[model samples]
Target: MIKFFKKRPPANLPDFWKTYENCFLEKQPEEVNSVRFVVLDTETTGFDYIHDRILSIGALNLINKHIAINQSLELYLIQDHYNAETAKIHGILKNGRGTECITEIEALKQFLAFVGNAVIIAHHTIFDINMINQALERHQLPKLLNKTLDTSTLYKKTLLTSNVFKKKDHYSLDDLAEKFDISMKDRHTAIGDAYITAIAFLKIWTRLKSKGPLKLKDLLKLGS
Candidate 1:
């Protein structure tokens, strides 16, 4: 099932995106450290957009630079199409094979409830977002209402200004984990990578807002 946003923009989305821009109306805090962010990911069967199936969604909530392991969401989904090759990458088994599993609808409902108007952050956000949107489309739920940030973008801001320390075209979770010295014990799980991105997002927030006002507008602008 694939869900598309209603043809008209939701009140929260600007006239630009047309799925409800109003959701963004809530005033963001004046400081960078005071925001609530949802860091998340999906474990899928493979790379083919049409052939793949999302096996899981793992997410954690961060508030004011703090992460509470207890305040996280981990949902395993039932898969109709399972790929054996990628199992080594994500480790999710098909056919009710996981420790705990839920249907796509169940996972979507839980994710919506957990996110509830918070901004979402992820590394290489487009892939995860596309996977989620596909799932949402399949479920016929309204499209996501929250704003999004990508750690791949945030991490770049932390580099030095000199041309000597030139930044790369793209940054990976492994690169940041190595650079920041964050633990990699949980490497590929949705929840684990989310934790890494959350920390990286926090670090970037600290570096960028260290000498600035750090308004909500500032964060939305980070995408540009």
Candidate 2:
């Protein structure tokens, strides 16, 4: 009789991945202020998760309402897939002028190391996370295990629900930046957007805190 066996993770997984996986073994902090958050952004060739490629990834650490500028990560990836039209938006040329581009594997390694087990924050979290997950799948690696928060959704929670003020079903990153008075000097770039997201999150956190004491789980529920 013939039988099919389930595939398993390769025993020879990279050291970096093992290190990242190890981070989850420790319990996460319950208090929102005590937890480490990684706010990140990705510049991609297009929105198609299956076909598009990540042009660059940018991330920064936030803890206790403080953004750790020194603990920031910016990585440009080298890929044969290049879309001229999309390049017009992100402004990353095939041969990035002065940017040092690395392989997808290397970028994943660096990203996993920088992210650790921190909660992830992004404007529209699903797209960014999916793009990164696709890259990981290409390398036969597991998807990211970190919890994620969407500023777009969380921002909506901060708004007052009244007959006079009807909230839109969707809020763009630009809307949050404008509402929070964050600068748009660096809009399209990955790192620039990450910085904007971080500030927007801070504003949202403040507003939510004003409503009541917010725990990590409560914030996640609001975003969800």
Candidate 3:
């Protein structure tokens, strides 16, 4: 006789998560022009994913090179973990005034519903992705299943192969903003950075397409 182990049942995901996951059941857009790109940024208490918490999340959806202000998302999370040192950078007070903030669970629920099946883009994609994943884990939710793109990597591809300007190992959002002449009006704010990233992404796409025909698959390969 052989002993057999029973398969574990899947966790019962909430209706919002189910709806978000169901969006992926449909095939993703193949053409770059038709694809929806969500540029997101998270303002955390600190760099440590396990220790720090997301103070706020800002994201905007870009389609066919257009970013509509009305379609943007800005969620301020009620903070349980606070760091004074990092506060100088993000400028989010623990008891900040003028706006109402929601719990992490509430914010994540809305974020998932808003994101749907769009491809995610960020400057340093991994850090932001990890932060969001950790937040999900805290709420016993699954990690994001959407594909991600790093503008830093995409920006590098836009540069000439010639030895004239050696590509730096890393690029900051400010670097891209200055290079692209984008305004820094909302620097350090999640939505503001997402807007900058969205603009930079379109500029990068223009440069990439100038070389040859482009598709959604082509850019996915460059994602972090």
Top-TM-score structure, candidate number: 2
lDDT of 3 by residue, 1-224 (tens): 99999854349878888898899998777888999889999999999989989998999989998897799999999888889998899899889746789999999999999999999999999999999999888877788989999999999988878768788989899999999999999989999999999999999999999988888898888655
Q: Which lDDT value does model 2 have at 50?
A: 97
lDDT of 2 at 38: 97
**Which is superior by lDDT, 1 or 2?**
2
For residues 1-224, could you state the per-residue lDDT of candidate 1 as single tens digits?
A: 99887586234433323323344677667665677888988889876555577888889988888897899999888777878889978877666363677788778777877876778898988888878877766655456767788888877766777767878889999998987889998878989888888887777787887867677768877842
Could you estimate the TM-score for every candidate?
0.84, 0.94, 0.94
Question: What's model 3's TM-score?
Answer: 0.94
* Candidate 3 clash pair list: none
Whichever of 1 and 3 has more lDDT, that candidate is 3
lDDT over C-alpha atoms for residue 206 of model 1:
77
Error of 1 at 192 (Å): 0.9
lDDT of 2 at 173: 92
Candidates 1 and 3 compared: the better one by TM-score is 3
